[model samples]
Target: MTVIIGHNPNFVPFNGRGTLRHNEPLSKHTSWRIGGPAEWFYEPTDLEDLAQLIPQIPDNMPMMWMGLGSNLLVRDGGVRGMVILTAGLLDDMIFLDEYTLRVEAGVSCAKVARFAVNAGLTGAEFLAGIPGTMGGALAMNAGAWGSETWAIVQGVETMNRQGQHQRRSVTDYEVRYRHVKGPDNEWFVAAVLKLLPSTIEEGQEKIKALLRQRGESQPMGLPSCGSVFRNPANDYAARLIEKAGWKGRGVGGAYVSEKHANFIINQKAATAADVEALIEQIILSVEQQSGVRLIPEVRIVGEYATTKPFMSETPSS
Candidate 1:
């Protein structure tokens, strides 16, 4: 049974559902410490609660899907309609057998990596450093070290905007570097991954080594979305940005990290405009400096603060 709560003053109350907040500041959810508010942000208690809640919202209203907010950039203009917080709910992890593990969308990548290692799985060690949740990993085909998120997926379960569910095999989607194109209007709910048999000590050591490398080369403890741009084929993004002399440069409160040019830091009260401007500047600089046009890896969403246009854009997933 699902329980409804009281209504929020700024937005729809949905007959008092699980967790609802109106005009919720999205900066609190994202990594960059920037962004405007979401008109309605709801965190369901669990999968069943979420399933029930989705259909109850008016059909014409716009909807957005988000997880952990690690690889996302919300515009200074808050989002319209409903924004589903997919991080705290749907958390379930189970070992199906010696080789397969099923993980829910809300579980963090870090937690999955540790769980895999504890289960004596070797291949998942690369996921140890990805700060996003499994749902984000699945959406972006997130990778590190050498292995990508989909490389080990045996199957997946997805939920539509209507909260209907389906199970699909890996063959259902086209997977590429930093991209996963699958069924429209559906997002990952869970995945069953295939992993290699290995000793706990071996997997643990690999995780440590990979994390150590990231720490040495990248600026941790700073407010930044991990990587701003995708690396061109056979070329590193950091190398290109550094060559363009963008290191330590910025507009407003956003600056390119000297430690890693690929990262744009929110040093002091950075606005979404500042970050977006920096992104465009980097893109232009890199294109002029090198012939390769670098595409953004970070998912940019929502709109500017001034205009409230009718919502139509779907959240990247």
Candidate 2:
């Protein structure tokens, strides 16, 4: 098999798709509102349009898939190649059966939660409060409270670098808590989620309560990437940070959220570097003080301008 990493094919323009200049600021794509630009950025109208452009793209060109960018952080140096925005192109959500739903990867988690509730489905209200698209959630095995995204996923439709698509079963993955692994280089296009039957009113009530809890516990109004670190062992990351007395710690525009210890917020006009530095400081302090190493839950991508600037204080978001 040939590697899809080296050739550059000319991209013919299509209707309902948009392309931008090289080095377009990545700040426009992330929830953190930070990042340099990608060498190329493309937003397709639909899956057909998306697939058409794939073969034209060079094999070695760095390709990054983007959804809502809620769980992502692109650095100041920007990305090297193509960044495909999936926000509008893959937003389909449909019923496959009485207890199963077909959801496109680009659909927002909140939208899916509402759709499930309106369709008399339960077990999906946990998605109501997540601030990312289904694809991002799937990539990160995004979870909250007691539920995770992949738990209800019965099957998934994925696309390869050559635009070849396939349907895979849940058993195909090595699933774990907040983690999912399958065939490499195959990204999710859609999912068939198995759900339980429930009343719309009941689901709505559950969503409301969850949202309320998030609002009270998190810095709901700030620009944050949600939880900064994964919980360690049986302990919560937030508690450790709070115990370290790092609350409200600020570096440039970023600050340790006074409201939630696990969240680092862009309090002012914070740069990506600001948040990055703060994350590191927190990790060093926590590890030195409590001997509990924290892991990040956020995805950090793109290049950093200075030495050793990429690794976060903890794990991937």
Candidate 3:
């Protein structure tokens, strides 16, 4: 096992100088519950501590910023360098104006939605159904119904690899269907969201309705990423996969969800490889059968052991 030492001379001091964990299982932190291990993981106490501590780490170390781990898939071989988790720390939300709110990266989407509703804001009701932090939602350009996350974002605060901060506008990023493009080295710290003033009762009612609608459509109690593939233009990926006869197909313990064709479920002891293979199979099969190629909305990363096939291999008798 590779040990993750925290004595990198280049690293700076932060709040209480937190310890590092070696070979920490990525599965423990992710929603999918399937990943090998991370070389190093750190959860700093606050933004000031992180800002001071991050610049001290060596420049060559690979780093990934994670929030809530809702839409990520880390492979079994594990991540190479450092994984910075912001779930436990960086929790702050403030009202900047009647129509605007400032939220830290760690705030959950559900909380943001409810907060807006309580404050009599209407446009942010869609956020209540998303199961992730603001940072992840922003990175994925996550949306539901008719609204995208970027549509409400007026400005964002981001921190670079060197721990320097910058304020950027929504126009800085090239927003697409489910992808976001902006400064490569920066990670979201906070965001200023624009909302419309409305009745508290109306906002609350809208959120309740959206949540009920999601429960009816998605597999609510499964270990899977939300909507594995992005909708292809005006058509739905789930409909395509279902039409291609992949709904009940599986690789090892990972099976395509019968309830929702676009979802891959960890039915019985499914490994990361099984889930990943099933995802690829769905993409390829849909493309070969229908002429349209499907693209994944879930983000895949990390590595796996060489002996483990991503898909099932035939047994040697």
TM-score, one value per model: 0.93, 0.90, 0.91
Task: Point to the candidate with the largest TM-score.
Answer: 1
Residue 200, candidate 2: alpha-carbon lDDT: 88
Query: In model 2, which range of ten residues has the least summed lDDT?
Result: 1-10
Scored by Cα lDDT, where does model 1 land?
A: 0.86
Looking at candidate 2, what is the lDDT of residue 182?
91
lDDT ranking, best first: 1, 3, 2
In candidate 3, residue 57 scores what lDDT? 66
Model 1 clash pairs? Answer: 4-16, 5-16, 5-17
Clashes of each: 3, 17, 6
Q: Which ten residues in a row are the worst by lDDT in model 3?
A: 308-317
Off by more than 4 A, model 2: 1-21, 306-317
- Say what the RMSD of model 2 is: 6.6
Candidate 3: where are CA atoms >4 Å away? 1-16, 307-317
**Ranking according to TM-score, highest score first:** 1, 3, 2
| Positional deviation of residue 242's Cα in model 1 after best superposition, in angstroms | 0.8
For all the candidates, what are their Cα RMSDs to the real structure?
Answer: 4.1, 6.6, 6.2
